[model samples]
Target: MALITLTSDIGQQDFLVSAVKGQLLQINPSFNIIDVTHQLSPFNYPQSAYVSRNAIKNFPDFTFHIVMVNLFERKPQQLLLAFHKNQYILCADNGLLTMILEEKPEMVIGLKLDSNAIKNTLYCAQIFGKTIKDISEGKSLLTIGEPDVPIIEKNHLRALLGDNWMEGQIIFIDNFENVIVNITRDDFEQQRRGRSFRIVFKRDEVIDKISESYADVSEGEKLALFNSAGYLEIAINKGNAAGLFGLQGYLEQTQNAYLQNRLFYQTVKVFFE
Candidate 1:
């Protein structure tokens, strides 16, 4: 049986996910439906991208993963389906695809659904269900829609550097309240070669010193470190870093908020003595 995975901001408190599953089963009863995650922060694309990126590769090859966060954000009312590194992914064409792909897709196709025929989350049942059914039945992607507009490709987040610092805003706050920055560890380490740097949250609170592990600091002590996924993380040992630091992850707007009782970090200066 072909496996289909679902990830979305749709909370489990409702019947959204079940309805999608029902639609899939109706189309192809023998197919397997898996849930990667349903607790994603609402409309948070970076979090969705990060979670999907880490999760998709673990599934078997030929798995179809669907991400349905913020499907109505942009125009053209389209969805994205692509195959990358032996996995198939379906999501809105917002930067989510580009963020995860990190490069051009092996095969990229846009899915044009009858917006009128399928409205609300129920559309996943109708549109996505039909797509998956077709694919399992040996239908080509080109059979779904006409050659539509090309996909928009761009990096939504910024990378931090040692010699040249790039500003990155917090893009996600997971349920654990760990703030996920737009900056990746690679860019941070490349620019920070042994220089002392600081991460400032709201009210000018500075977090200095990178820890080798979460246990490197005593209980209630905050530390900056590279997470297992190789992303720079700001966390407190056995405590809530976001609560202690009053840091807000994923800002809705970027303005002088940095100046208004907000956190700001000095540019990481890299100098070889």
Candidate 2:
């Protein structure tokens, strides 16, 4: 059976998510549908990219991954079908493709939609279902859609680095309220150069060392550690780190007014000595 994974911001409160699955199954019963997540924060690209990138990399080759976050960032003209590292991704033509992959895909094709038809979530799923059906039947990528089409490109979120310091944005906050930063272990090590470091956030709170686990610290004490995904995480031993610290996830400001009133509440900075 072919594996198909779904990642979306559409919550399970209504029938929309299951209805999309029904559309796919109606077209091909052999597809083994998997749900990656249905609760991604709407319009939060960095969080979606972080989750989708990690999940897609672990799936077996030739798997089809569908991302439905921010599907209508603009009027939907066509969808993107990307093949990278032997797996397939189907998503909107929005700039999210580059954000998730963090680079160009091996191949990308624009899947056309009927202009006359009402463009909605279910209609989009129907188009994706037919395309997946065609590809599984061994249809060439060029035959299914237009090749070498121009796609919207967006840069991935990266940490700000300096000679003695690194500033990382809060990308995700887990169910337990552990705050995940954009900095990876490799980034920290290279910059540290065996020097002592202090992880600082929200102005006054500081952690002088990284812990291997939450239990390394006393209950309710703040600690920093590299998460399973290799990103830096700030947590309190059996407590809510984000809520207690008043840390917020990074948000992209769309207006100039928001930029003028900028605050680094969502940032964590590390200084090496």
lDDT of 1 by residue, 1-273 (tens): 789888988889987788878877888899788888888877665667778887887889999988887776765467777878989888777777887767678888778867566456677556777777788889977776544458877565454443434455665565665666666677776566666666655545566676798799898777777666666677777888767666665533434655454534312122222
Compare the candidates by TM-score and give the number of the best one: 2
**Cα TM-score per model:** 0.82, 0.96
Candidate 1 RMSD to the real structure: 3.5
Model 1 bad stretches (over 4 Å)? 74-76, 147-149, 160-167, 194-196, 203-208, 252-273
Report the error of model 1 at residue 95, Å: 3.9
Residue range 1-273, candidate 2, lDDT tens digits? 668999999999999999999999999988899999999999999999999998999999999999998999899889999999999999999899999999998899999999899999998899889999999899999999999789998898999999999999999999999999999999999999999999999889999999999999999899999998899999999999999998888876533675544446789999999
Model 1 has a clash total of 2
- TM-score of model 2 vs. true structure: 0.96
